[model samples]
Target: MFKRILSALSGKKSRTSTPVSSVHADASPPSDESELITVYDSYGREMKITRNEWRDNVLLPNLQQKWSDADELYSLIISGLNDGFVADLIPAAAQLVAIDSNPERSHVIQGIVLLENGQLDAAETTLRAGMAKVGATGTLLTNLAKVFTERGEQALADETLWRAVQTEPNLENGMLWWAAIQRERAGEEGYLQALRTVAALPGSWRAQLWRARHYLEHNDVEPARALYAEVLAGGRFDGGALMMISGDLGNNGQIPLIIELIGPVYDEHKHDAMAGINLLRAYQELGNADEGQALLARLYALGFMPIKSQLDQFAQVFEQMRKQDVQGVPIDPESLKFTTLALNQPIWHYGLRNADWFFAQKPEGASQVGFFAFSKSTDGAEHAESQREDELGRLSRAIPLYLAEAVHYWSDHVGTCYIQIVEGGGPVLSGAEADGQALFDIVPPMMKYFVTGEIGCSGEDDQVQWQIALSLWDCATRTKSATESGSAVKADLGALVLDLETRLLAGVGLGREAPLDSFYLRPTAEVLPVYLTELGQSFMLTLLANGHVPKSSMWGERAMLDWPLNMALHWPTLEVAKLMYICGLGKALDYQSDVLAEYKERSLQMLRELEQARSPALRLAPLVWKVFGMQAELHAYIRELPADTSPEHKAWLDRVSES
Candidate 1:
């Protein structure tokens, strides 16, 4: 019956008259006489009456008519209409006009209708007008802003939203929406503020989590960690939060803390790949390599690929140890033995400098002082023990320790070695003759090996000369082989040596050119032939061509021997080659010019390769014979060339011919 009435009111059904009007003649009169009405008898049969009969005979005559109020009339009319009926009855213009008086309510209804009808402009206009009249308060402004935003007017929408927030400060909805808008506009800070406001609202876990992330992004680790812990303590075990905190702690080098924090999380959720991976890294960084390896095995059992980068990093720490003899310093048996035997190595041997120096150069926050000593098999165990005790043992050892005294004397004054000897022996050894003899014995063998690859003990002065010769040899060899190696090797060596030289020279008050070449070069050269042969011509040539050889030599010599001038001369030829390649010709040159310029370039290149070859059979004759034409120009100032040759041409010819 209700369906029939609704269909009839909507004009989908034809109406029939009912006898109830005749039975109840005291009822209200019909508003429209021609309108159809359907009446059903209790027996389910329809009864009909003529319009005139219904209006005059039964409806109109019995009705008590009164003047109609417009508001009441409008209400009655609107009540009778469905959404579709109202839309069909009222024109858009009439609706817009009706909105002026009760804009909020009118626009709300109209906006919905317009939006439904795909009339975005009409909807926006209606919503904005309604909002303007209502002072941007309550749901009206929020709805208006939403419509504007939906239509892609974000700025306008945001403006309206802020107004809405201000209009109803106590309303959480407006504030939350406004906060969201701010977040979208402004990035992390905006989001953080917005999320904070959101979190103040009851039961906003998602908001709180985002706020924590904002703290983490800014490196406020303590707060981030605290927040995450708070969340977890509150029984919020989010996987993402756990992962983030773990990674943060690991990156900050808080390896042990990271493991402790994430251990439970990992155990509870063994299936989590990220947790497993991070756990592995944390263990490795904390020096719990065994534990880290075990975790990796566990991850493998759980069907995960082993993280290669973390594995490599762990391997590197150990590999670096193997390359250097002791835990910290380079591999030197004497230094190691002395360090081991000394109860307090820093005080006894003077090798460990002041705490200030160590602290300044310390790795990150490393605080502990430790040492490792090595005893060579050739240095008889008893002799090694005696030397260690003499140099590093407590002051009560009774035996005079010369090396310990020398180290102590050298540590105090930069150039005290020479001065002390001149002053008739300082603290280490007494008497000029004894001091000179000790210096000669201690320094000469190293010097002789460097100069000529032979240990010559002719005399004290002879040792000094031998040492100088070795220094020259090292510089020559370093320069000669500079063009053969790759740039990375050369650069690494250079940086290393430069740092060493700076330290050594600074310690001794000696210039870089001081003739300590024999001390450094002889040992270096002895190992160089084997080193170069091991690194074949190809590697050597690549290193030299890239100007790495000189850099390596400089670093090695400076750090090991403190030989400045010798280190400076190591890669002159290679540097010259590089200069020529960079300045004289580029790829733009013609093939003929490039070939002509290739001689000096090729010669330097071949020299590098030759250093690498094990035998002459491995050498390329073409590379050996190739001469660099431009390099000969280096000799131009030494001798005059033909009168026909221009200065530039002569310079170029001289550089090539000189080499």
Candidate 2:
């Protein structure tokens, strides 16, 4: 049944899941996908995920079809760029670059590929060279400005974007880009005037969104909502207007506001696939599968078919949930004692097989990323001189170190492009044209991707359209640690993580570089689950690191660190395993009588911390509704818990019941 749904989207039978590298091609095509020998190139071999595997690995409903020409192919490629067809996009992008009939798109797409491949300079050159040839068109300059921002060249980005706006005053995108810079640099007061200019422009969907967002940011509810109302009613501009306005709250991880604003619309617009898709993904991001699925069922019943690719994207998300819901893998019931020799030195790779911090040496130094099973190692004695510098402190610092490297890695690869269907498939999202012109060139919200995780991709950026990378550790840590002495709290950790990310993003020079839903800020709706999984992992990790199990807050304990150790529970990769360990831990403790007692409050506290702290992980989702859903499930479990519920917890549950 699933395969049939997927086949309907891609118009191709699901192929065998074998790596193309492992198979040798025969002279003739085989009878079926099984018989056919799939070829893997050098890149494919390196990724270990062949186009076939990436295609069939469960990114929803397989949405690829052979195109007659590269132009048509390019259009579809743009569509797939964010839709989990990234690996597939490589060859397609290359195809477009090779066939340079329209050199303009060729340059842009090639630049995108170059950016993806970590060639920032080459991408800049490609875009600049194109601009010299074609003049500073909004599309070229908008793209070029993105590279500049990724390179951390704010001056250049601002200048180029200014040029883009002047070069094409009518191009709302140029104006939007210009406005984003002004907002970031000058704040709302300085940004508003420019936005007004853009908003006043004829058929400026994005400009209007900026104006609406300006209002939203200032806590001016009526104008913001009114602006959204006006623009959404005007027509379906490629950019989802409501998202541009309300969704902008992602910068602050404003899950509640997003829910409040969109929830009613979601309730009212059940038949509007576009609105429903965003709402569903938002719910999923919030980690509320019940509501998301409820909406999904309604959408599916409505026969919402926008495009094959989007259907495939949605299918991939559902398939993942189905596996978890139906044929789920059983986690080991026994708690695993974590034992490791904590090395004090800065580590990136190598050393011990059991070591938490594994640093792989690069030619110059070492790989930026150092994959680890746990946060700060338990090297120091359990009772350190300062109690504050317990396992949580070390783990917190260690985590930033590891993740900052990823940000640095990502920073170098700014202006990265790939299709992720943010808005679900809906008649190919043919948004209404402004000024009787189709802004096929302007992809509404911006483009960003993350280091892929099994459940969903999570990156450090705070905003949906604007991506933040954790780059330049020394700068971020030094700057932040100096601000606050001694131990860095998780919020400080967020700052350290985000500053470097911001730097890494602006880092091209500091260094360099560097879901969904039309619901488009997310690439595709499927990523909602990934965000939920990531956010859940974060909340659990925070909660457990503080205390959980027989011995809570046993960070430095050698005999029994009863807390959740990084999961050996494989989710395709060890990184994801470590990342989502808390969720697994939560599941394990749920069975224990002692742990079940405070589970409701504990989980609720974790959720509250997510909001109070404004966690970076919270930004992973469009919303954290899943946190509430988890609480709901915990409440159900609380009811099932054998007697001996504490008065406080009982009171809380009573309060919940009353509500």
Candidate 3:
């Protein structure tokens, strides 16, 4: 039944379209189509092979399908350049000459490739022809200036660069180029003079924004606010831009200015989460209790699942502030423990969409089995000072999620994880204080059975001992149904989980089987630990994308974004891992996340592979493709997909498009 549902839903076409512009250009493909690949060839040196070999081995196999896809093709070129496989990109860039849309960008890409391949004359002609047809976009002009500089025409380059900035004062590359030139010729004074000139340009909010930063730096609040208001008036700024402005004010000790400039207009729906954080900080620092509590309540209502920890922490601070004001009680904010909010909420990949539908379809005899986070049991001893302690905390949450996914995949039952939030901003590793009765009080009505456990580790670094005790609770009878416990070395964690999973499945009467049509597959021992970590990271990123948590909070954890793609690329045959990868990439792309910028090429390559294999991940591929500036391809791809029958799947696809 579930397979039939997926089949129906996966076939639905999207109800949107994106237009592609037409541009005509006359240019021939590269004359030397060498099959023999090497680093030196695109660097103006050669290792030769016949045209037939090149066509069969390289062009047809790699570059042919992506010819018209500017984003995919350029991603390939850039990735190849970064990895020293430039020779492979010559044909890719050659395809750019014939692209219809993004003519200016296409020309820039081709010119850069030409310049890199030592075709100075060809590069110059290409840039000039592009300018004639496309009317000189800042990016096009900037690259054309580079070609001039490469040809030792310093005067022409200088003239072209100046024109580039005047033509598009907001282009970072062009503005940076002009700034560097002025600074070299003069100094800091000249840079400021050039910035002022550009800031005066009509419709140049970026320049105005930069000037505002400068004013704030010099403690000139009025000028900064005026400039910021002008930028806001342009209405071209996005949430990210507002966040940047807020960051500048916050960093410059202009906290009140942040609220003054942004408070009136700030909407959680329209502004980045960081802007709210700034306002909250301002209210808290000023002891504005009513306003602080109001803002905190708004943020909490967002229900960002992954940032449960961070939001809980925020709640604790605000709660403390409220307590001190009303009760006149001295509460050390640090002494606050459990969150008063975001309690008992289960972490599911797809948010509450179709939740009723899910439980409604459960088999008559089957039961809802929830797996809550394992408590960190210290047994009253001084907690071991192991570096792996953090790892254990993450696993406590991750293990439950993994187990829940497994249960749902292998049986006709509801499986979900309850990783409650702690006051200090991390998963609530519930110990004795958050006991069974306490947990049972918070579960939803459909949950008839639940699992809980305690986990701890000893020793440090490479030598660690891990222990976990698990119990199954019958919500109907309000009794412990079964129990399982195990101890293992850090290297043997997978073996331990597998053993526990087997017993838990048996205890609940679930039979494990691999279904060919199901998206879920049992993760292997080799992949489980790494995949668990990825799951936790994926959850974090998904929350971040939803605007529930500040991006700054996850700065040190970028591996959460990169590792899924890396792991999927490494273990291509693992369908389970690929699911996580697609989910992670979709969240990152949907949110315009910068964390995945470094892995763009890898992600593109993975997408291509998934496309070819017709992987299940293709169901969610539209979300990933749209934000990579591949709107045309995104529209075309969506039109080809059939309507998905699964409400969960359809909701995700629709939500990304709507967002």
Deviation from native of the Cα of residue 602 in model 3, angstroms? 3.4
Q: Looking at candidate 1, what is the lDDT of residue 17?
A: 19
Ten contiguous residues minimizing lDDT sum, candidate 3:
1-10
User: Which scores better on lDDT, 1 or 2?
Assistant: 2
TM-score of each model, in listed order = 0.24, 0.31, 0.49
User: How high is the CA lDDT of each candidate model?
Assistant: 0.35, 0.40, 0.63
Q: Write the per-residue lDDT of candidate 1 for residues 386-407, one digit (tens) a residue.
A: 1111111211111112111222
**Judged by lDDT, which candidate is best?**
3
Query: CA lDDT of 404 in candidate 1?
Result: 18
Q: Give Cα distance to truth, residue 364, candidate 1, Å.
A: 68
Kindly list the per-residue Cα lDDT of model 2 for residues 1-659, writing each as its tens digit.
01112222334222121111100111232223332223222111111333344346523232234443555555555434433244445566666666657767767766765665557788788877777777766667767777787789989888877777766554555675577667788887668888777666555556666666666667776776676667657654443445444456555355555666666555323223455556656665676655654555444433322322343355456545644554322333233332222222222211111122112222333223221222222323432121222223333333433433443344332222111111111001111112111212332222122221111112334321211222121222222111111222323334433443343334333242221001112112322223223432332333333233233422222111112221212122223222233233333343232223222322333344445655432221211123224556545655685587556545544433332
Tell me the number of clashing residue pairs for each predicted model: 45, 59, 9
Candidate number of the best TM-score: 3
Candidate 2: segments with Cα more than 4 A from true spot: 1-91, 98-104, 124-135, 147-156, 166-177, 217-219, 232-236, 242-274, 277-659
Error in Å for residue 391 of model 1: 35
Candidate 3 Cα errors over 4 Å, as ranges: 1-348, 351-366, 381-389, 431-433, 512-517, 546-548, 589-592, 596-600, 637-653
- Report the C-alpha displacement of residue 42, candidate 2, in angstroms: 30
Report the alpha-carbon TM-score of model 3 versus the true structure: 0.49
